[model samples]
Target: MTKIQPSAPLRSPHGSLLRRKAKDNPTLASILGSYEKFSTAALSLVVSDKNSVFALVEAFNAYRNEAVYLFESGKNVPQENLRSTMLEELFSWLFKDLFAILQFDQPTNYWAGKATSSYLTLTFAPKNFQSLFEDPNPKISKKDQDFAIGATVAIKVMASKSDDSAPALTVILPVVAIECKTYLAKNHLDMCSATAQSLKRANPYCMYLIATEFLKMDSEVTPEVTDISEIFILCKAENAERKKRQSEGKPPHPMHADVVWELFSMVMGHLRAVWWDPASSLDRGKVIGRPF
Candidate 1:
């Protein structure tokens, strides 16, 4: 099958804050909201210092120590599995939404630079590349292909910024190259290297999104290396209620930094953004320990 490409970029008046303007800006807006909660609470949250290793460990622990409730398909999942699935869904939303922004901005710029006509040249994947999530074996029977690729995920491209009579360059735009991956194994540097190769093979100007934590466990585990420039680490943040009660005799929750890092080492360094919902703050009354 042919590789997929991004359709024409969507044109939005705003910048990254475009998400804030939307009903849901899961990437920048939501993650920053979570950071704000951490800053306002007890633990003095800080970004990376000189030591990337220490910073990675500290940040990973900070987020992992606390647990939160999960809501899925408008319904809450079992507390035991909430964090696990919520993590996946949050990461998926982050990549999908951000790609929409790039698709808009890049093409807008291309059209403006060329001063050309209004039509856009769009190239997209047959199944939105959902096959990566399907069967592990690419070499399957024709009947199994659907099980591997699932439904055709369409990246529809329509006129975004130009009128029909506009000059060829007036509205025409360059296609975007977008890639998303879920890493269950491999270290940061290793993953970066592999992804870099894939991107370079296609186009280095591509937008890359990897839904993996600083420390990834499981069968694909590899050495921990740090070269996370293009990669976006979509992970969680510090739990609000837990920290406020940390000093009071109430011990930290079971999934604290120590526990999470025990399996996947050094998760903070690669962290680019977090998914946050202040709705959890409404549970303040149910909190056990005294606020710091």
Candidate 2:
């Protein structure tokens, strides 16, 4: 018999809520159901090059449109009560699909055999106590990523240098962190930047990414200077087009297959490539750019 646990910091709090929204939306339900089944099937598929990757992404975009779509009426676009949550769940499903074809069964010290998952609640900041008057037992703070690939590591941070009684802090960290949004604004970018900075400070190896369907930020606002590794805008459609279609009772725009392909390739490259191996570099005689 297996024990059931009420989820908290273990995962993002969007799965159940998104499922509830799907209950009233049959198209979404079908798409999600089919996507979930890919867990066992996708590993059998072959993707040898960029062309194959793009082909797979094209099919995926078709499925994605149904799950994260907005309905058109005229000027008023009707959205699900859990619109943002549904969009969040799309990323959850996406990474799951991408992970399906990867080799996760190969055992490694990283990620503890839980090769891939989405909407994971990870520790951005571990148990921190700086002030002398702070609580005797300080609680840790966490942030949920739409998609993450990493390990839950046990770390010890002595509460006080002079005291022997205090124990270490255990942190649930993500090596690869991704945030998915239906739209991104200036404030959203700022918050994402802050998170990227905080998590990177804690886990320097962590790769932070942002994926959004629509771009709402100002033209001058770019993520290049921020801690974010990359930000992918998956659609060319604008808000006005969405509104016009919604008024006519049409579905939202589909994601660009090329953009999705880039995202998939980026993650795949990161995972498969060796980030650091100084000992092996001496023998192989190959040097790559640092943080390139």
Candidate 3:
């Protein structure tokens, strides 16, 4: 009998086009400016403030352990509740304290937490992109509109508006959107991918992410889900549980520290790009334009 050889992996026809497009993506370029500098600043904060890092890790572990306990105890606790609670606490740690370490002047009026609104409406229309549109009069299509579905966490920057006839009032746009999952299953991944794609269509620059406590899905990045900038797995399942499973051994998961650091750096980078003013050099001592 002749030995059979494994077939080569299939490739998408538009792979080159996609790569080229991503390379030319101005939004991506601007957001990821000076990666080394941003990462160094982010790392220094973690290394300098051991207490904050410890607190964040403790909070994350506690959240996961609580969920596990609730599930194992046969309680009817909804996974959504656990996920929401965890993300809320995590974001508080990130935006309130950790991110401030990177900035020269503390940011004021920045909000990061669960979104109260049903749907995030875009103020401006996409001119160059065809995937998303600005619906001047957005109507509710389904029980949950496509735009609002699966939007668990939001980060907003406050803006002031003034008119000749009215006093100035504060308003905000959903600058960053996140989808959280207790365990990222196939269905959850699909849902998040769809949501991210829709958000990108509407606003190409919107920072979109899918975060999960446990990574229960394949490690491969779905080519179709190009809009999702990152997929973060916060923690791994209990080692004992994994070991008990005879067939599947240890699953692929990132370390807690790495995940936290990466997430923090990404968040800080976005904040710097969007909220920080270069001219004033508010929190940043000096203005350094993007080198590349």
Which structure among the candidates has the greatest TM-score?
Answer: 2
TM-score of each: 0.25, 0.64, 0.51
Query: Model-by-model lDDT, in order?
Result: 0.29, 0.57, 0.45
Q: Which has the better lDDT: candidate 1, or candidate 2?
A: 2
Error of 1 at 174 (Å): 14
Estimate, for each residue in 70-107, the C-alpha lDDT of model 1 and write its tens digit: 11112452323333333332222112223233333432
| lDDT tens digits, residue span 1-292, model 2 | 2322211122323446545656887754665564444322223334445665555455555644555543211243223434555445444434443333555443332331122332223333333555433324444556666667675655443435456555654545677777877778889999999988887766666778888877786689878889999988878665566557657867667777678768767876776666567777876676542232
Clash tally, candidates in order: 18, 7, 4
Worst 10 residues of 3 by lDDT: 5-14
Regions more than 4 Å wrong, model 1: 1-37, 40-48, 51-60, 68-202, 205-211, 214-292
Regarding TM-score, does 2 or 3 come out ahead? Answer: 2
Q: Where does candidate 3 clash, by residue pair?
A: 104-283, 104-284, 105-283, 132-201
List candidate 2 segments past 4 Å from native: 1-56, 64-82, 85-141, 158-170, 280-292
Candidate 3 backbone overlaps, count: 4
Tens-digit lDDT track for model 3 on 236-286?
A: 564334335423542333238667667666755664563425776766675
